[model samples]
Target: MALTIGIIGLPQSGKTTLFNSLTKAGAPIGGYATSTVQANLAVVQVPDTRVDALADIFQPQKKTYTTVEFVDVAGMGQASQAAKEKREGLSPEFLGHIRNADALAIVLRTFANDNVTHVYNTIDPNRDLDSLNAELAMTDLATVEKRIERTKKAAKSGDKKYVQEMEFLQRLQETLNELGLASDVEISAQDRVVTDELFLLTLKPRMYVLNTSEDMLGEANEVLAKIEKGEQVVPESLKGELKGIAQVALRARAEGAQVAAVSAKLEAELTELPEEEANEYLEALGLPQLGAERVIQVGYRLLNLITFLTAGEDEVRAWTVTRGAKAPEAAGKIHTDIEKGFIRAEVTHFNDFIECGSFAAATKKGVQRLEGRDYEIKDGDIAHFRFNKGK
Candidate 1:
């Protein structure tokens, strides 16, 4: 599956710059707050060393890597007034793009820009976070209310099904009112079907992107370390710029949300350079990897996604699926014929195959396992589908 994530933040947060860096796609960079009015979408390859290693073994004529799609959304607010408007915040266009996304990445600007204005006039990341959260929460609230109304009407028709659904929505309404996320609220599997179409924003998994200024890239990353350690640090002069990101990172870390920090301006500029020149710059900056790459990896984790390999002389390909996918379903990702005419899967862990030098070597070492259709595929498994497709 091509996983999708929605990118949202206040204007001038370097969201578009970061998007460009991640996907290697050029998106218009706004000079000031509110310059971006339309959404930019890009499909980026998920870089994996495993794919490279598998390619070495199979020496495929064509190699395919899995990708993630990101959509950069404009109009989310960090201002108090805009935050107030967020209760009814989502526009038709925004909701249409976001509701279908598998996950969300909330960008927080920890960078300072005199020329690039802050939406709130002053930066306070906590308040900005409140703005983003309130906006998302309010949107989810509206979705639930509309459902409650529908369920109530359905309940009035003497159908007992709607009665249970009404109570379920009411419970959800109460929980959401208490600032609880819809995903955290308890609901039956049956009731989940009723709310399936709702696509409550808060129910989607989230990643906190901390966008830092050039000078503070290291400091911003240090803040990430502290946040991971459960320690909070707010820069007195840059609270608005830094704290919201810190809090969001802290919250994400504590609540199992994926988190990363990067200087979008720096990363974007780096992306503009040649690969060798970029690495030289990164080395001079004492960085391990581009912040954009970190963001992509974290976003991938937030979606609860895993990669599996299909290695052969013809193709060395990466396939993405939700974590618990079984053999047939994973085969379905490649082609229906493979899944339908399913036989056993000859599998070896990617790491093991890499260590053993080749697939034949892995078989010689007795590391290859023949798994039936009922087998659950794990991430990074180098699989050869032994199917009887009657060509």
Candidate 2:
């Protein structure tokens, strides 16, 4: 199954705009709260230069890129937060959409517009982030409390495992009550089995997306570059408009979260243009790529996923697997039967293959290696599995 990430933020935060840019779905964007009552889901191919380069080299009949599903969930307050304050927790319909998401992209608005309304009547990304975080934490706290009660009952049967589970749940409850994420509570490897089943929203890997004004895009990129390069100085002129961005960055650093800034309105407009025109427009704007694309790539990596390639005259495709996945497991992503009849994988690094210009030349240079089922797949590996039909 394609990994999914849910897009969430306050009303008028440009989440739908980002979704439109990422998926090119052109979903309606407005101030109406009911507009997003039903989640908007789209699967988008991950943009990879490596995939294009491989397809060029192989002259393949087909080229496939790994895909990720983005679900534009409705603004938070419509159901979840209202229910949480009543001590009832998230509604089933709302929970169902996001419960299975592999990660989350929290959209925080840093732009100021007199026409577009902010739910809180102000543009403060940090405040918006904290408000959303509280709601998610509350929803998770309710879930953890319910599980604690159940585990307490189960412990009465004298199962030591239940007792351990009860202790873990209580710890989770305490952390959530303290406004901490379920992820903040460190647990043993065995304990993860129990916690992973909870599907706690706060525990999911998350990225912060700052939706900035078109005029601020360049400055936003500059701020991000400075942060990335570990520069300590900021220009006096930009400090005012970038305060929200700085606040969000500090919060992200405190929690070890990823952050990206984008002009969602501009990106949505760019999506309406042809690819070549869009590239020229982006170049004119001094952007390497769309912010929506950066968010998708960052969220993909946040899930601890890596892409491996399969190249041949027939096809050149990118496959997604969790980091540290073994050869047979990666093959299983293609077909279970292939994994069931596993033999060995012939592998070459993408860079090596590009340098050598062909498989035969790579083998001549000893760059291609034969790997067993136990071999851990690495990113950029170009692999071909040889498996028997009758195993």
Candidate 3:
């Protein structure tokens, strides 16, 4: 499955800079005012050491890694007074790109820069989040209200299904009216089937990226650590500069969302250096890894996705599938014909394969097993599907 994440934020939030760092695409970054509605897009290969190891073992003709498509969209929080008056929070062009995204990476500025001015003239991530959420809620409210009108007419036929839908739409309307996220509304599986068509912005799974200064990276990580440990209060000296970061972290935890910190300017500059040199520079800074890598890894997990592997002399490849995906579904990621004709899967955990040195050895040790169509695909699983091509 191909997954796309839309990178969105208020103007001057360093979203483009982060995108450049993540993809190394070298896209131009603009200032506070943007003149173009066009979005920057790139496909980033998901970094997995297992793929590299498999490649080394198999000496494959080609090595393929799973990928994530990122769309860097500008002009999210730019609704004018007239647009707000009409209950429209974003331009149709912006929504066109965002609506198709599988998930969202919301950039929140925490860095202070003297050269670039903030859209609001102050650095407050909490307030910025509120502004963004309110706009999303407004847009969703418009969507729900439209659904209610149609469902109301449909309910007149006395069908229980329409009545149920009407009830759900009204509840969504109420929630969106109060500036609450559609994600927060209590929704059943049946209701989810109905709401899936709305493409409500607030309903998407999101991660908050705190764009911090180079000097603030250590402090930001420390604060996030405390927050993760369920610390309710941070040090007094750290509060003034990191209050917004702490607040956003708390909210993300409460909502079961992911949060990451990155020094955008620092990372962007690092992209200009060679990989080895950049790693050395990061080591000198006492940082473990690139912030861009963390964002990609976390964003991958945020979508509840996992990777499975296929190995051979022809190719050693990584494939993506949703967590709990069945064996046949995972086969479909390779080829539709395989899914249609799937008989059974020979599966071995990655670690077992590594320890045994090869598939034949793993099978001899009973570490490899045959799985049926109902078997769930696990991360780091190596799979070979048996199927009748004539099917």
Candidate 4:
């Protein structure tokens, strides 16, 4: 399945605004259904400096980069009676998009705009967060209920597998009923095969985005701090962007989620400029890259994916495969024929090959070695496949 992250928020909370900025596409952004009937889909390139360095060295005929897909969905909470306890669970159509995503980004408006209407008419991040979370939890709970019913009937066949499966699903259902994610519960290998298809929406990893105004970009945290302290955080007016990078780094150990802050408006403006101009603007803002790149990178991690490189004078390409992909499977990514006729692979770590200056040099220096089909591919591997192509 394509890697996706569904974007949903309250009306005029900048869902499409952020989407258009990330993709540089003119997806509609407004308050009415006439403007956004279908979720806008776009695949943004995953930025990696290693890919660029490989291209510089090989000067190949073709270069390729990995990508992440984003689906911008319409606002939820359409009914007065349907929303439970004043929280707008996702709309059915929007939930369809969210159910498939590997991760999620919740865009909470911390910015002020008299021109744009907040569905709640207040800048309350906690309120927005609670509404979104409740919706996601409800979606997952519905999935678990269906699964429990099916598994319960199947257990009547006197099969031990069904018993084990049902037990696991019951625990999962209970945890999700408590409004927790799939990751919140641990699953054994045996249990995983059973619940794999539930496709529970809240089971997805999530991050928080605090959209602020220009002037308050630096002070966004102080406000978040105040909110975390349970102090009043209602904003009359403030300045920042469509993004606030979460207050944690990519590698920080976490049980549930990550947080980021960014000015989506600023990133959108930068997207309209040339690379040189964008770089200058980013420098002025004291940022590393567009918030979209960070989102893509972090979202990629939610899937436990890594990139392996292949470089030659003929072609320099980056390949996306799971971290534990074996040699034959990695070769299969290039061509099925190679996978079918796999023999051995000439493998050299990219950094070693680069340091030694050439493949032959690396092999001679003992940095390159031959690996069999059982060998698992590692990130930054420079591989040459040895297969029976004539067959």
- Top lDDT model: 3
Candidate 4 residue 389 Cα shift, in angstroms, is: 3.9
TM-score for candidate 4, residues paired by index: 0.82
* lDDT of candidate 2 at residue 220, scale 0 to 100: 82
Report lDDT per candidate: 0.79, 0.85, 0.88, 0.72
User: Which runs of model 4 end up more than 4 angstroms from their true locations?
Assistant: 32-37, 83-92, 216-254
Instruction: Tell me how candidate 2 scores on lDDT.
Output: 0.85
TM-score of each: 0.89, 0.93, 0.95, 0.82
Better of 2 and 3 by lDDT: 3
Q: lDDT by residue for model 1 over 128-171, one digit each (tens)? A: 76778767777788888888877788799889888888888888
Cα error, candidate 1, residue 8 (Å): 0.5
lDDT score at residue 77, model 4, on the 0-100 scale: 45
- Going through the candidates in order, what is the number of backbone clashes in each? 5, 0, 0, 23
Task: For candidate 3, give the lDDT of residue 156.
Answer: 100
Model 3 misplaced stretches (Cα beyond 4 Å):
31-36, 229-237
Clash pairs, candidate 3, are: none
Worst 10 residues of 3 by lDDT: 232-241
Tens-digit per-residue lDDT, 15-132, candidate 3: 9999999998988888432235688899989888999999999999999988888899874667777777887666666677788888889999988787888889999988999989
Q: After superposition, how far is residue 8 of candidate 4 from its true place, in Å?
A: 2.8
Q: Ten-residue segment with the worst summed lDDT in candidate 1? A: 29-38
How high is the lDDT of residue 246 in model 1?
67
Q: Cα-based RMSD of the predictions, in order?
A: 3.2, 2.3, 1.9, 5.1
